[model samples]
Target: MLNCLIIDDEPLALQLLEDFVSKTPYLRLAGKFEEPLQALQVLKEQPIDLLFLDIRMPDISGIDFYRSLPYKPEVIFTTAYSEFAINGFELKAMDYLLKPISYEKFLTACNRVNDFLAARQLKEKKEKDYFFINVSHKMHKIFFDDILYLEGYKDYTKVHLSGSPNPLLILHNLKYFEDLLEDKEFIRIHRSYIVSLRKLNTISRKAVSIGNLQLPVSDNYRDGFFALIGEHAK
Candidate 1:
């Protein structure tokens, strides 16, 4: 079910939206607030999938309130005025509803939200199979399996691959890739290096070799590294 919140200063408008939300099978009314400030507080504390927001509020305008958030939820703007429609769409609002909204219009907006969410999930799933990185001002599509290891310098990382003689220099830290490839077949053996477990050719007490490149296994990560290899041996 999609979690929803309503923020409208008008008592009648809030009640109408509450009624519509209660009747919808896929939507759950998380909260209804007349004060945008209180709604903003609830937003910070909870995860809301959809927002039904009023444009003009006494404390803070809905447009400004939405912009203030670091992580924005899908928004359907509710306003009596038509002037703010352009601004609302510019901020990527899912839909806009005029005051005294009909049930038909509301349902259409909800359907759009559902479609948007479904498309987003599909895109994210496809991204998990492969990722793109910038190399020499061009985006390079690198499959996880193609990567042999990663080397980190001060503020950049060198992506070493299986057949490439030269590594791709990317302006990102090793820690970024470490977190990105966490559950994938990659393990960080040293502060400045992460090696693909599948590509690891040999292991020693103090180091591991991927292809002809010898990378150090620091004491900080040695125990976990040994534990991982031990599992593979079993």
Candidate 2:
């Protein structure tokens, strides 16, 4: 089970998050904090897997509090302001939740955590890895390393495997794979595509090649993708 914490000055927000956490079977509420300093103390004392943090607390802002930590848990930033969306992501938050957060949206955040945990387990399993993904008629076993890339289409995803003649189409999206693979070993070079890092052979200004397939990099993602490759370059 994942240990979760809710840090919000508002009593109602904390209660709602606590209730949501309680209903989720995989999560255990470690503590709730009205102050960011108190939450930091809790982190120093024990392990926490996830944090639901409100951005505008009195003592220290949530973003500042999050940055102050020596080690950080996966955070879902909860706030009324949409202005903080980009900044929250820059902090590497799991998700940015707009408050008066709906139960459905909160559940979606929990699902993201679940997918993140599952992918970490699969990576740890390594040689023993096998992922069962539901397709049209039945579930299919997919080996982790054999996947070349995944492309998200409207209400569906097309899985491009290493040597497959055709893409295996499934009802999923880029978001599903993003949460499922967080080791930074897979990258979203395009809004719709997540490519396996191990599969990349050469990268140029416009395209990245995996084997003989040259995939175009979207303009918006180009700089970040280039920086990632440069940072990890041999």
Summarize candidate 1's per-residue lDDT along 124-175 as a digit string, tens digits: 7556867897878999999998999999997899999888999999999999
Which residue pairs show collisions in model 1?
A: none
Off by over 4 Å in 2: 127-234
> What is residue 164's positional error in candidate 1, in angstroms?
26
**Model 1, CA-based lDDT:** 0.91
Q: How high is the lDDT of residue 92 in model 2?
A: 89
Cα lDDT of model 2 by residue, 1-32, tens digit: 89988999999899999999999899999999
* Alpha-carbon lDDT, every model: 0.91, 0.87
